[model samples]
Target: MQITGVWLPIITPFKDNKLDYQSYKRLIDHYTEKGISGFIPLGTTGECPVLSDYEFEEMIEKTMEYNKNRLPVYIGVGGNCTSQVIKKIKIAEYYEIKGILSVCPYYNRPNQEGIYQHFKSIAEETPLNIIMYNIPYRTGVNMENETIYRLSEINNIAGLKDCSGNIKQTAELLMNPPKDFSILTGEDLLFFLTLTMGGQGGILSSAHLKTEQFVEVYNKIKENDLEAALKLWKPLYDFIPLLFKEPNPAPVKYCLEKLSLIDSDEVRLPLTEISDQLKDKINSIILK
Candidate 1:
């Protein structure tokens, strides 16, 4: 499948500590028609680490059910344990998802060779396409472009969620990308930059808001209307950082609640609600 355009690492809606299927369905319905390229459930933005195994599977099931094949779905199936990640991939395969966004091993800080082996093992286990997620800040070990290029040789290692946080590396990869291997940014702020530099698109968390505007920016850029794309991107440029200022999903959930897209903005423990100050600031932005 082509991994392009704005893919939302969708937020899981919770109500009194339970999966809010009603709201989750609403979100799927809401975004499917918003020109979003696809959906990614059970990602970091979905609070993957905190979800129970049952909830994890349930989320995948609900996503497919609600989405109804209206758009592509890429389930986030990742863990530090290569074996465990493979197991999750098996679960995802049971569904009709387009692919899996597997993140790099975290905390273990695996070396490049180890990183390479981790993905290699996964590729061997499945026929499904894999979009390797490389967010060094979270994983604690960067998957260098060399390792990525090497992996691209493996036919099923289809793409990457490029959050390496190194523009030079990103630029180099974009300049000489492997044939049929996509490089979609995971960083929301870098959406336009990635497009300008020849990236496929982004798996953006900030896309949960301003969905059409985000799509328009990608469309404009692809159309080579840089001036028009910049016009759309400039207004969103400053506000993107605030959604992440307090941690993810919290601020995003708050905004969704304000818009009545979801019933509540409650996040699990270890990820509390946004600060009152940030809430007020976001509220003002929404009002404007």
Candidate 2:
């Protein structure tokens, strides 16, 4: 299935350093009500790297269980280690998740050929659709459009979550991508621009707040109403940068906490809660 529309690469809400599954389920139910196209549960927004193996497994299972086919779920299965990512993919295969949002290898910063071989190996290993995630700042090595196009030639290497932050590259891929390949921008701020240029949709974190507005941005574009879409996107255009002003899910979780959507704005170590000043700013925007 072509992954389309606004998807939440959902934050794994924590309470006193615990998984807070009750809040997680509640969050999922709330998003489901908002009519999101799908759910991405263990992505960067989900804080995947810090989660324990048991927590990871439980997150996937509970996400699928709660979803119960209501919407497609793509579990994040990626790392610098190809073998380990494959192992994670195998584990994901055992469950009922729809696909895997595999990211480019970070830290190691492999060359383009290495990136190609890594995902090619993954495509060979799994029957599931693979959405290659290309976030250069975090991954260190950017996967050029040449490498991306090469990967798209593979049947199961379905599409991309383009976060290269390079408008030219994103536009190039959208211009002449492989048939049936979906390009879903991972940058929440670029959601409108990406869709305007033929992206499928977004895997957005800011979406967790004004859920339907994000969806309607895409819907308005699909209806060829740029005027209407931008009207909906104007406020988001101003607000999205704040969600990342304090390093990702922290600000996102904080907004959820203030909205009473989650129990606490707790996050794993290495990722702290938002600062008091930023919290006050977010409160002003979201509460208004």
Candidate 2: list runs displaced more than 4 Å. none
- In the range 1-288, model 2's lDDT, one tens digit per residue, is 677899889999888788999999899899998978999999999999999988999999999888878998889999999999999899899888779999999999999999999999999999999999999999899999999888888999888999998999988888887788999999888899899988899999899988989988889999999999999999989999998898888998888887889999899989887898987897787666
The Cα local distance difference test for each model comes to 0.94, 0.91
Q: Which candidate achieves the best lDDT against the true structure?
A: 1
Poorest lDDT segment (10 consecutive residues) of candidate 2: 279-288
Q: In terms of TM-score, how similar is model 1 to the real structure? A: 0.99
Given candidate 1, what's the lDDT at residue 189? Answer: 93
Residue ranges of candidate 1 with Cα displaced over 4 Å: none
Query: Using Cα atoms with residue i matched to residue i, what is each candidate's TM-score against the true structure?
Result: 0.99, 0.98
Error of 2 at 239 (Å): 0.7
TM-score of 2: 0.98
